[model samples]
Target: MEYEKLVRGDVELWKRKLMKRSSLLNRTAKKAQTKMNGLIPEKANSVITESIKKMVQGALFGSEYLTKTKAVRAATLEELDKEVKEKLNFYKKAAAVEGAGTGGAGILLGLADFPLLLSIKMKYLFEVAALYGYDTKQYEERLFILYVFQLAFSSDQTRMETMDKIDHWETYKEDAEEIDWRVFQQEYRDYLDLVKLLQLVPGIGAIVGAYANYNLMDQLGETALNAYRLRWFNERENGQKQEKQSGL
Candidate 1:
């Protein structure tokens, strides 16, 4: 129970951090990213957006064959957290290696890293869902994975909006059809644009690629862990309320 209390405290702190307004530096950077996004040709933007849309849809529909991890049941939160952390480390290493290999090769290979890295991230989320005792086979659960992805990579404003949806997922799920793929693609591409661009440079590409990929995975791991914790505590509180109502 002590561990549960500590975990709950961590989740509360994380939620507060998530909802906080962006700092001046972040706001400035976001403005610059917006300007850069606006400068891109419409045709280029359309192609990129369509590609990401198809890639993500493919991931969601084809994930059943990709994810081998079974849903974990009958485990304490502590046990689940331990396994999740271990799996996070494993994925980080894999991403780093992929980044390095692609980055070190040449510009063509570096360009190829985008879809490969996306696949790795999606697979990692699928496994994390199973570890948290959620079945990705369910359509809603796959949508939840997309929300987690958006939460981790979106701008500060979008992050808060996504967090609100995640916080009230049970109610939100009732009417949720699908996410806006254009918004999803734009936000994700903007978030990684600078670092991934640096990963194309000849000399420093290898180092930048490895460091960027590792840190990206680390960020996703932290976000995914806290997102699941929110759901875990929500379910527990709801169960308590139901039990009290029944006793009455």
Candidate 2:
């Protein structure tokens, strides 16, 4: 009963967060992202678009496949989250270090931060999924991780849309649109633009990079935890319904 109460409280907090509206800063950041993208040469933009699409796909299908699945076990939500928090912290620190290293360097080295940060995020998600007792090696679960990514980094409109799909995922998963990687990359870039753009500057780049990467990882961790929590609660509800119907 206590365990259920704790999970319920967490879900409530997550609800408030998801329903919260975007701020002026968020709107401005998104606009800035769009403008920055516009500044890129069309040919270069196309090249990047393709590159991001392939990079994301590779992350989705790659490491998780080679990883051993966690043995299925029964544990309370708190126990699960305890482990989850540890992993989140571990990844957060790692991302911060990576960000600081790249950001402190000149422009040429700072450019490398993108793929490195992406790998950290994807690898962390896979670990989180495994901790939550999900099998990332499965195609659908890996796809679910992408939705979680969308939920974390997308603009408000896109985030809500992605949230709905994740909320009803068991049913909605089958029909979820083939993620438009073009849009995916756009929103993601826009979301990161404000902080990441600053990371290109000379003196302050390191500070911005470390702070930004730390927060980004934190955001992703929250999204992943709540998403899996939603799944856990829904499964519990389904189990209860079945039990009552069976007069257990």
Candidate 3:
């Protein structure tokens, strides 16, 4: 019970933080991103579109990661969290390095960073989901993982809508046709607008790229952790409800 309370406390803190109103900087960034999206070229849009499609496909349907790794045996949430954090830290450092290398390599490599970073992020989520005792091989679980990604990168407006979707994922996912990948790609691209563009600049790109990827991975890790917790809590409550009904 003590452990559960502590876990709930932490989750509540994160939920509150996520719900905080957008700051001036965040609003400004969103507006700037809206303008930039309109000005971006067809080639740039295509690259982003294609990269995200590949990412979603690999995460949802690819067998490579599932084949290579076993589902983590269920343990207490505390134990699971420790393992998840270790994996998150490992990937966080790796992604930062990848960003820096590409950022320093000029236009070609900077552009290459998009798909590379997407792969890194997706891989980390797969591991985190497995660590939390969810089977990454399940299509529904993978779709949940994608929602976690969107939650981390979406605008304030979209974030609220996505939060509701995640909160009722078990019920909502049953009837949902499929995620609107176009909206996912747009929200993600818009979220990264300035920071990603800065990564293309010649002199300062390395620093920007490294910093951006580091934080990006960090945010994803945190979001995934909380998302799994939300699922666990829901299952826990449902179990309790079933036990009560059975006793009656």
Best by lDDT: 1
lDDT of each: 0.90, 0.84, 0.84
The local distance difference test score of model 1 is 0.90
Which RMSD values do the candidates have, in order? 1.5, 2.3, 2.5
- The predicted structure with the larger lDDT, 2 or 3, is 2
- Report residue 12 deviation for candidate 3 (angstroms): 1.4
Candidate 1 to truth, TM: 0.95
Candidate 2: list runs displaced more than 4 Å: 35-46, 65-74, 246-248
Show where candidate 3 strays beyond 4 Å.
Answer: 35-51, 59-67
Candidate 1 lDDT over 117-193, as tens digits, reads 88888998998999888999888999999999999998888999899989898889999988988789988988898
Residue 241 shift from truth in candidate 1, angstroms: 1.2
Sort order, lDDT high to low: 1, 2, 3
* Index of the highest-TM-score prediction: 1
Candidate 1 residue spans exceeding 4 A from truth = 39-44
Q: Provide the lowest-lDDT 10-residue window in model 2.
A: 65-74
Candidate 3 lDDT, 66-151, residue by residue in tens = 43446774578878888888988999999999999999999999988987888888888888777776787677877888889999
